[model samples]
Target: MSHLAIIPLLLPLFTGIFLLLLREQRIYIKRTISGLSSIALIAVSTQLLCAVSDGNILVYSLSNWPAPFGIVLMADRLAALMVLTTSLLALFSLIYAMSGTDRQGRQFHILFQLQLFGLNGAFLTADLFNLFVFFEVLLLASYSLLLHGGGRKRIRSGLHFVVINVVGSSLFLFAVGILYGILGTLNMADLAVKVAHVSPENIGLVKTAGLLLFVVFALKAALLPLYLWLPTAYSQTSAPAAALFAIMTKVGAYSILRVYSLIFGNEAGPLANLLDGWLLGMALTTIIIGSFGLLGSKRLRQQVAYLVVISAGTLLTGFSLNSQAGIAAGLYYLPHTTFATAALFLLADLIVQRRDQMEDKLEAGLVITKQKFLGVMFFVLAIIASGLPPLSGFLGKFMLLRAALEHPALPYIMAIVLVNGLLTVIAMARTGALFFFAAHAVDTATNTYIKQSEPEPLKVRELLPILSLLGLCVLMTLWAGPINSYSLETANQLLDTPAYIDAVLGKEAQ
Candidate 1:
């Protein structure tokens, strides 16, 4: 009922438009505007989160229109959490870009704001069709961002990224069309009501539509088979873009959780548990593939990119459990992985810049400037990324493992999760040794790495973003109990389909 629900979307929408008009004028001016806007978003999102923390579900009906007829923006705990996470991630990424990456491309700030607009809209939307609209908004902005710093590698990766997403979009439209044609509504709560009462003759089509939507969400989430494009796209993009994209896959995860738990939830009779075992199977395979990918990667960026894949799998594994504890575990793990992996991306960018010509390749290169500083940062981030003890990562995995103990596939899940963690540690250690230790070895025969003068000092500004993200991981670990309790509440709220439908559709409809 409150209007604040729409501010997250409007703020970014207007800012992006304004920045677009001011495009290429004064770089510093654009940075200031973008930075302030990002900060504002964080404030507004934080307020929204606090407002909804007490189990309040605020719905903003556009133009005073009611549900199933007009567009609506709903802010429950899950939506607020997502918006806040996106806001935080965007701000840090923008800060990193201002260090120099923004200068590498035209309209970087404009695209950044637009992507945020899309991301916020996606998280708050109450309609499936609107979800598609938001997806396109974010994807369009990401497309430009991916190619921001033009290069052959980026061009190739962007091409595949575009084609695959275009196909996904097409499938999304087709599914939406089918659902609307049959059910006569695209509003999610309305569809939930209609789906349960679907005519037997049309149940097949309904299920088809539901599964199609899953395919689109899975593609976005980067599930096993559909995730082939992620590593290359993330690795080749500019560092800031990669960091922001850390939350993009979570969008897919959010979609699956939202849609499945609502329209196709336990109340859906035949459609209940539609994604049941399917998600767990795909998630396990995704983790395995991602682990091997991390081990085999020759570049730091690619390794970080694969870590994203592994995180996605881990998240889905918890969500697929279809239990309160499991979903809570996934929600808790979500922010941890996002922040950790994003820190790694930013760290990788710094390493690449300081390595002279060696870039992020795993091979030994010239001794980087501030090797000790960067090395320590890498070591800490590595432990975090690999889910080692005493960090948010370990707590997240521990919570998930405990949750899965009651599930049927406990053995497979436990084995894969444990092995993936081990492989991640090994890969990170190896990469660290090559980049920090091996590179420092003076080729006594040739003294190739021996420099006559010390390299430039590391910039504090450039390090801020990575440190900020890592700091968040530490905070998450420090406040694990309160955070996990909140997650449990959020999960409980999510599974209460009747309440959601009642809120969106009104009590009379229910």
Candidate 2:
């Protein structure tokens, strides 16, 4: 069972290599292979999640070597859940791409699989250097994916995105080097143990390395000042690619949680709470900026991009509280926001495609195809995005707010969250009314022009992916209780440093 830790990483790795070997124009074959691999990943990840749900940590050491000296893959509740989420998103996004977007570029399937490979490796790796390696793998794939349906706008945004991430990768290397030099170990579990015993004089170096590491993760998570690159990059990418990118930010948040809780957590004498104040302040500022961006966005994809920023802010806000309850709330909120944002991005694409020349500009134009159905879908998604009643978003936000009340930053965080929610509602309402309700020119039966119009219905392929994602949101709402319970359990597991160390390095280490 412990060997199962490597399956998620390997599934995508081999699938990507196989995809690379296929003929470029063999769309059907590529789609079939990608779909099957995604399904298999979902199955494997679900099993892993179930296996680890009981507080078990499955660690696979490479070549029969021991921890702190050998490469290892570790899966607990948190990692398994992240893998499941990534697989779910990958499946639907691949389906959406098959609808037509895959034709926009060569090697779409290959890049998509490689992206998953990177994501799974990042989630499962127990070594810091391997984590950096996985980051590069994912970043490299993303650079190509961002330019998939090449356009001038995409090129510009992709250039900036690539430059920023490359710099971030450099910083990651520097941080890893500092840790390896000081601690003589890069395995996360070993680092956790070693960090607790660092001499007072050397503590400053460790803290410096930790802070630099936080900066890299922060850039990935799109925290406040570091988030400027995200909106344009996300908005300009192809929709399916954007939907997959939805999980990228969560990867950053996951890294922070995993690294901080294991290495610099409560057990790490002087390193504890080093990021609390900075994280809280940045999270609040991110929410404010995202809200303003939402209100100001002129394009549909751009608005959705800001919504991603808002989701990041909400997750980080919960995490910055640094309490078990707060962290659990963040974990619960993550999937809800991820699914909802992905759905919105796909919906934006559907609307844009149907509008012909109008695109997704949020202006009065040609009547959208499948107007009635899309109208309802957009309405439901709007409610979800705005954190309105009877959806997972509302419940997630409620949990975060409830948890925040106990924190000293409650006033600021709560007020900003509420205000941000209101702004989101306003922005979404404005967009919905423009796209669904605004009057458009129409041709009558007698061939005369009129000011009223109706839209064409959507194809099943395009509709399926959007509806599937929305369905997940509904399922998440219905299953919030068990899900939240699982989140709490996962959070407890993360905060329990001794158990993780002992699981990886054995009882003697603890």
Which candidate ranks first by TM-score, i.e. highest? Answer: 1
Give the distance in Å from residue 47's predicted Cα in candidate 2 to where it truly belongs: 0.5
- Residue-level lDDT of model 2, residues 41-126, one tens digit each, is 99999999999999999999989899978898999999999999999999999999998999987789999999999999999999
Task: State which candidate has the highest lDDT.
Answer: 1
User: If scored against the real structure, what TM-score would every candidate get?
Assistant: 0.98, 0.97
Estimate the overall C-alpha local distance difference test score of candidate 2. 0.91
For residues 149-207, write the lDDT of model 1, one tens digit per residue.
Answer: 89999999999999999999999999999999999999999999999999999999999
In candidate 2, position 369 carries an lDDT of 36
Task: Mark the 10 consecutive residues where model 2 has the least summed lDDT.
Answer: 444-453
- Model 1 residue 94 lDDT score: 93
